[model samples]
Target: MRTLILTALLATTTALAATAQDASNTLDRGNWQDAASLGASLDSADGYTIAAKATTLGASVSPDSAKAALLKKAQSYANQAIKLNPNSASAYFELARADGRLAQYTGILESLGLAGEIKKALVKAIDLDPKFDEAYVALGLWNAELAAKGGGASFITGARGDQVIPNFEKAIAIAPTTIAHRLEYANSLLLLNRNSNRSAAIAQLQKAVSLTPVTYWDKQDLAAAQKKLDALR
Candidate 1:
């Protein structure tokens, strides 16, 4: 499932870039403004346009400036999309991804509201589309991190470790091809290792790195995981 999602994302990215290039070739000032104006409308017709714009900006922009802009745009569109189609779990899922990115870029504490929003939206997405692997993965990460931080009320406390691991596992089972999802699951394992499962954490990190493609960030994470393993050894 992860593989399918990655493939779809890659395909979508390619198609979008090509479409944008085609539009640029013929775009006049009037057309551009018209498109932008249409995009701002809170309707299904506009949701994809807004999401595409945010995704394109997110992919092209520097992490510092680009993400901030993307987060704001994504939030606005996501809200509108939800209002337009209350059952559109994908809209909520997209918002959750955007919020998660913001939380990662800023500290979780700083973006707690966004993270909470993601959590809420994901719950709804799961209710609407139970097979949504991405939502489950995001939820797992959110719950694990929040649990680690000692947030989410008393009954929910550290017990979330039990909850998080299963969600991640389900996500992995559903989408084995998504390296990012597995890496996130491994991260949660590493956190758990800090308490009781050091050996298992090391194993998970090793597998994560082995499965990851050759990207700068992946290499860096692999190196860090190796260092951690060495320290444990």
Candidate 2:
């Protein structure tokens, strides 16, 4: 944060999309699977799951493979994209996202080390685009997850998870209607301080469930949000 944010303030906020805000316009789903082989030709959509609904949601219903092989494949594409354009914030963002997925499968100690890399990448993405609310959501998730870990875990990564609420609120402030921001904030609340924040979490989830979907990913998230809200209720 200190390194990347300092640099970003000095640098211009480049308007670039890491993942397609609207998939139809910028994302080409046809060649999505070819990202591994395509290398530098990767677009903002390359590293993300083509079927996030199936890949993520399926894991909830059944024990899907947890190898994170697809995430690593996506990482390769992000790596190539970074090599091709050093200044591409989207590339860095994808790389960070991939690292996060890998950490989920790899375990906590290894993921703790990877947190630094993820923080740097997300910070750089924000440096490139100050209004990158998605990046903020990612940042909030990072903090929230680490905060959930607590104590030595936070010290290891220099993460102030207690202060993660501002990150979530900042994203929500920037784009009030974005269900993702609300859903993620609700998650952070429950993860960090569940007992006290249960009501708040439900409130955010309520807003999230009521919102309309604007992208394919949004539909998946909305479904998850409703299920989660049901459980909470």
Candidate 3:
């Protein structure tokens, strides 16, 4: 009886690992729905994290009309992951991503309201994992967006324009080959102060265009970066 139970437990663990791998493979292929479904079925923190990531990617690729709904779903998944594992850096990161993306579709005041939550989530993610390079990129974008909103928003949020490049630089230092980091850094530079940073922004975009894309988001950003670089030049 003991041997049978142990065998069953081992089989269950193996099945779960295989399912998790399948979810990851689906995500890598950009089959967001399958990836999310598989992830959510696992009922684990890591699984919910994958669901959040897949849903977030779905939001990004969806039409503008569908984006907000998917982003909200992503937020829900991320929150679920956090509940299961409070120390989950990826969960916090995905929550921040979903919130920040959703902000773009919301009204001005509501968007401003979300800024604080997004920043807090990103900060928590970074605190949990100091080497989380994407969190730094997201933090940079947060500052850039607030700075773009001008004095009233910046004052309300305590967002300093000076922090944008520094955060992006930190991400780049940590993961230099990441296409999104270079592209987003260039994007933030242009968004905050295009006139003064145009040359630097162009350099970053050039770097982004030269990097190999490893995921759907990376490919999308790489293409955009190339287009932007061409237009700038």
Q: Going through the candidates in order, what is the number of backbone clashes in each?
A: 3, 1, 0
Q: Estimate each model's TM-score.
A: 0.63, 0.76, 0.95
lDDT of 3 by residue, 1-233 (tens): 99999999999999998998899889988899999999999998889999999998888888999999999999999999999999999999999999999999999999999999999999999999999999999999999999999999999998889999899989989999999899889889999888999999999988888899987767888888999999999
Whole-model lDDT values for every prediction: 0.63, 0.69, 0.93
Model 2 lDDT at residue 166: 78
TM-score of 3: 0.95
Which segments of model 1 are wrong by more than 4 Å?
A: 1-61, 105-110, 151-159, 210-233
Candidate number with greatest lDDT: 3
Give a tens-digit lDDT track for model 2, residues 39-86: 223243432322221222223333347437666665666666676667
Please identify which of the two predictions, 2 or 3, would achieve the higher lDDT against the true structure: 3
Per-residue CA lDDT of candidate 1, range 36-116, in tens?
Answer: 334554245234434533453343335566666666666666777777777887777866777777676676457665665
True lDDT of residue 109, candidate 3: 99
Once fitted onto the true fold, the runs of candidate 3 whose alpha carbons sit more than 4 angstroms away are 1-7
Write out the backbone clash pairs for model 3: none
Please say which candidate is ahead in TM-score: 1 or 2. Answer: 2
Which residue pairs does candidate 2 place in steric collision? 14-128
